[model samples]
Target chain A: MTEAQTYSFFLGCVMPNRFPNLEASIRKVLPKLGVQLEDLEGASCCPAPGVIRSFDEPTWLALASRNLALAEMSGHDLITGCNGCYGTFKDALAVIHEHPDRLKEVKKVFKGMGLKFDGKVEAKHVIEVISELGPDYIRERVTRPIKGIKVGVHYGCHLLKPSKNRPWEQTQKHTFLDELVEATGAESAKYKDKNLCCGAGGGVRGSQVTVSVDIAKEKLDNLIEAGVDCIVDVCSFCHLQYEESQEQLNKELGEKKYQIPVLYYTQLLGLAMGLDPTELGLDKHVVNTQPLLDKIQD
Target chain B: MTDSISRETIDSKDIDPEFVDEIVKAGADRIRTCIQCGTCSSVCPSGRRTAFRTRELMRKALLGLKDEVLSSHDLWLCATCYTCLERCPRQIKVTDAIIIMRNMAVDHGFMLPEHRKASQKLLSTGHAVPIDDANREMRKDLGLEELPPTTHSNRKALDQVQEIMKRTGFKDLIEGEKMEGN
Candidate 1:
């Protein structure tokens, strides 16, 4: 057995505030897999990479670097449940590390508070951690293997795009996330526009709700066409987009209502581990989980 | 409403040649490397519905059509999904270049109201979308602490975040104020 390494968990804003079910499920599942989730207390937002980074570069880099610097202080690498946070750390670190001038600026921002980024800590997405545990290892621990359910995998943009910065998914051919999704005995369904945005990213949802939800509707229609029971997502923001779009699409497209539930990756993993659906916060989903729950083999 | 052609002659005098240079300065130096390839436009999630043509926007930047690029609502139309970034054969940072243009837009007071609101929430609460009462209940229902022990729950830590933003002059930048040198 490989010794599990401890990681300081960087809980990005949306997970804690909007999707606590994700926070709980991750907290519950990873420990059983021999990974310790240390609380990176006092960490601020990954500041949402796209929203701030698009609006201001130096501020985004400095703030993200501050979060990374805190992770470095823990003497362990960092892990996050949100792809947005993952990208913020990954892209911010890559930018600052590659450009000494930017790094110096970031250091100058940190100096007043006595924090420094030795550039030692690396960011890992929750899926990356699951991948690190290996599918075979994960498969062995699945007591109540999910069966007969087709899942559309939402690989949120920051999860894999900008391949240079992200350690996982270096190429479009990378099956890391798909492999992890399949380990729990569910079929990772092949869906349309597999790599499209969930419409909640890049501040689109924040700035233009109708347009954002419309894009999600397009993705959802594709998912429904592909005939998936539910969506398995790694990023909470993307999770929110899919979950909300179910209702939004239902309203907009009259007489062709689509109702699909969504699960953050850990929530699904927790259920496969035989944790009570309630314990995994399954019932907390905006869209009812009963449809998917009914499909679960007793 | 008339279906008529309205034409205006454009010359080098009507363009800001430094526009592309500004975008380049913002970590998107690959702007110069774009080959007018329409690959970005084809892959754009935003262009499917909105008038945000990725290739045309890049071309506008390439040609230094500063006013056309900056003072248009179309600037915020991109979702920044990076699909265009991924599919661009030129490997142009298509999305990043747009972001750079948006930054330039903000400096020129062409910022989107909604983005400004999100940035404000981030500035004040250290979150783009702060915890609401509904989600507070949701967090409690999930058996986790209502506040995730972040800057939101700790005022002192939030002060540090604000200080970092202040030092970087990010607050002023987002709020549409002049930085010290300006």
Candidate 2:
């Protein structure tokens, strides 16, 4: 399939609600780089792959198909900032392609609603789009590197899972996300369990909060032990876990606060592009960033 | 929380003859193919802290231990992080397979309450995590629109989401369960 030069932006539930700044940064950075982020207007949730899909496969397909139909109507590929939304769109796209009977079932439902999902629209993540922008394009464009800042990269599971489905780097020895982190001149700090999750997927954080916080607490401990200044992630769900769970982690552990700030890759990229950190929404972060920002070479 | 629970000692009556096929029909087509390598279990992030052994779960699914697999709280312990799926040597699609089991569990009227609340929120608001006032101020701070062009801002689109939910019985399936909250 020939990749389209322009794509519709698929903003899932979290970005619009919990982290609008991340959305603002993506909008500010990508257009300047020549990637058009068309609004996927009237789009609903990706219906949350882990939660909704777990209960009923056909229901999940119908919901996902509705969003894909919206994107297919727009004549551009869908580019999502969230991994769960990406996984849902790509997984639904894959199932329909692999199973005609399923597609027929989903289409019959769409027919009742006067919409169509032709499976022509490809669901691309913003990270993959940046990588496709090529390393040199990013390197040459860097106007101000927040040089010497160590970034702990969190590649959320949904972004690169079921290896058969996603378009990101190969699971083994993956550096696709890392390479993008370095494009800003901030080193991708080596942390144990870097490939592990932020412990907030599959509705676990909502249902099993203790278990979810336990897993993230370990990952953060590992991150801090690695001496990284901040966390950089491509998916907002992981950002939510890493950013929101720290307060809970400190409460549960009865320990000193884990105050590491979480930044989406686009915010880091915006800083490298010489965009004001306030315009990138850095000041609105849940965790403190003053010490981390102080260390940046500016 | 996990220390008190012990692995079930399987007996002949524990096996439901059709349970394996039922799982396959649910989309985990390769459950019987697991070689018990313990690779999936070792790499599972949830497995390390919780009793959710991916290898053991597959063994139960293959052995047709329906009562043991569905009735245990350990069933819901997987974070669906796909770490096991990434690490699975057999390429079992472990996370998806676990979700298939969860669908079966939901059918049997077994589900965590927190998940049910989220499902209810999705049905009602069209967004699973609906917008709150704090986020509204944050959006204003970023000089963007208060609400995204989503169901939260559009009623007709939300009705479309509910229509899909109703047509698919997702509303009933999620709301039908009366499990006590975890």
Candidate 3:
């Protein structure tokens, strides 16, 4: 009976470029949950916090503020599906607010473009929006409950770090994600070092993929040990790492050691909503998601 | 009968005393408050499998070992997950400090080649990972626009992004002098 919550969807590079299925999943699922997405036209990258910010803080803030300014023009808060992009916008805003001088510099850069950022708009992760809607709201919409699937929830970094800026209370251990996962009637498995980094952030993946995969191997090992059907992640970058690392490990080891499917949270939630798996882009994953699909169908 | 052990010690002359202040000014205001606590390193996921020691890196930065700290590849190994920042008893912005140190490292020409390529991509296209023909095709097949109304589909928007990069010196940072190896 109420109007849909409208947000300017900030699509970072990874999802739309490398993994369009994650983009597909978000676009397909959110509308069914009473959320309407508006494209932030002509928006660039989140500029990526790890790489860009590491090189030059001022440039990072300038680029991020430009994105924020675009969302302000639309008169809506921006919501991103990637943790990296979410981190960049949130961290940039925090820096600008905390240091007025930096905001002044950002505003100076904007002067030439006829853009202004009053810090009126904010950035949120897709998880934050869905979770804020509460599990009960999501629970009511489930047409097909995936009661038997056990999931390893990977709460990739940047979703809950620098706790002072985030809405969540506890950083180390949090159940908001787990609660959402359970809402689909799936068990959110307890795995070792559940909150560990996916090893792809901070430019490590681009710089040294071998090291990044090695770090991911640890998390994958823990998830495999926990006997989960698949790895459900909120970040597209982390999703890429899990899917790519499994394939990379198999290639390097010359064995099919890892085959666990990686799903963005929406893809999993879409299945519970009885949305077609192909429509959600489950067929696009590197690791086979059929086993999870078959289990849910059973 | 000679001892096989070789020891390397830092020379006082190599220490840049103002390096700590440089990082602090860059916005890691709590770098001086570190008490040699290994909490950051201990919680680091990368430290377990790699040679990255977060606490030791912080210690070196605090000691003003500018050359040693800035030139080390270990600086890039941090995943920037902020677990250390969350757990730091001193409430230090440990990860932010590391990121600032990376910026300083890049300023001194110690950038990774991959990062240089990525920055160049951002300069050229509005997105770091720009849309390609394959993704374009996939997007259409997925019932969405080939280009999702971003800078890819908007020329003026892309130009605006490029202009911001130019004004911020990001374009120069990527296109300027050849940076040193990582």
Candidate 4:
């Protein structure tokens, strides 16, 4: 087999702090599929959904630009596990790409920090990379198919928005993640508000808890009502929000209510690639994947 | 009942006199450069969903109509996706303004019901919601041999987060239990 594609992984804020398993799962499986994930030195948060944007817009852009600079300086395009980071990085690039004046200002801010981004490095979410690898490549790598499983895919806002200069081009004719999910032998289903916020946005979870949870609850209800066995997310924040928020809502409602497990797309792929559940950080997710696990036929 | 606040921009001098300077100094100095450009609103996920316009919020904050800016439901609708902040031609920090307004709202006790309920849950449980119980029960019913474990927090993470919040000037935003009813 040809050597795996090597990439510099950007495990944005939520993954490190709340969804460590996402990085852990991708690390476990990518090697098996001949993909090498190199760690970028001293990478900080993409500062997407985490940083307050309005009050310190330049600072926020400067921080994201700093991350892009790291990858550019290292001579590797940045790959992120979180959808939010993908959006933020792409948005930053778009800003610098569209306006020379703004680019100059942002570049000046980065210059003081000893970084220069010549815009050579591009940002991509894991799904985009998988899509580029194509379904045939993915299917060939799968040693164990996650059969008998139905997955509700939550693409999250950042993964699918602004409709201009997407991190990965969308043809208005293609469904990337859904195709990849099916390649692993699991059914990729959609729910209402498939593109809705997980209510984890805007640093809302820390500041505006109820609205955040309510937003999460909306996602949960839609996924449950759609009758999927589990929900899979590309964003760590959405994964945590759906998993944790659903549990809290069920408790308040006083019943087992919606018991759908939430999975990182990497975890599901890792399982298909024959990595053990323990190795994939399945044991660490807030949402129980026991239902989906039972269906794994391991 | 208070009269509806107008979105009109009165003369900068007629407004709180210090309002424009204060907002500019708060790091949103680009408010005046907004040009009523709908770039922010057009790109915002929340704005696309619920007409949550950040430009208007900036206008209000710039005018120092603090009450109107903080009390509006628009700030609550922001998803913090940063699409607006990223798209703003003038580079206005729209999401940060919403956060500042939310902080202001918490101070004035205008926090909507959504903020109140979730805060209580997060405070009582380290998690915003307890997922452990569901996992235990679901594993049992599914006849799984082992349940996935919950990641333990040593309070350091929480403390670190609190320290950041304190430093950011929202130290008491959570509103202590003693002050719950009062």
Writing each residue's lDDT as its tens digit, candidate 2 over B76-178 gives 8887878787777677777877888888888778877777788888899988898999999999889988988888888888888898888888877776634
Candidate 4: list runs displaced more than 4 Å: A1-4, A110-113, A168-174, B1-67, B70-73, B80-182
Candidate order by decreasing DockQ: 3, 2, 1, 4
Instruction: Give per-residue CA lDDT, model 1, range A1-298, as digits (tens).
Output: 1125788899988888888888999999999998898998888889787788877877888888888888887777888999899888888878867888888877877885878686768888888888877999999999989999999988888888788777664577667767887899999988778887878877788878888898898888898899999998999899888887777777776754777889988888898999999988888888999989998864
Per-candidate TM equals: 0.94, 0.94, 0.96, 0.69
Q: Chain A of model 4, TM-score against the native?
A: 0.92
Could you give the DockQ of candidate 2?
A: 0.65
lDDT of 4 by residue, B91-131 (tens): 77765456555655666666655455544333343233333
Model 2 lDDT per residue over A1-298, tens place: 4345688787889998998989999999999888987888878888888888887778889989888888888888888899899899989999989888988888776666778777877888998888998777898889987688888888888888877787755646689778888888989998887888788888888888888988998989998899889999988888889888998777777985698889999998888888988999999887876777778854
Among incorrect, acceptable, medium and high, the docking class of model 3 is medium
Expressed as tens digits, the lDDT of each residue in A1-298 for candidate 3 is 1124888999989899889999999999999988899999889998898999999888888989999998888888898999999999998988878888888988888886878688878788999999999999999999899888899999988898888888897546899999999999999999999988999999999998988999999999999899999989999899989999999999999999999999999999999999999999998789998988988888
The numbered model that scores best in DockQ is: 3
lDDT of 4 at A107: 66
Model 4 B-chain TM: 0.67
Q: Is candidate 2 or 3 superior in TM-score?
A: 3
The superposed Cα distance between candidate 1 and the true structure at residue A17, in angstroms, equals: 0.7
- What order do candidates take by lDDT, descending? 3, 2, 1, 4
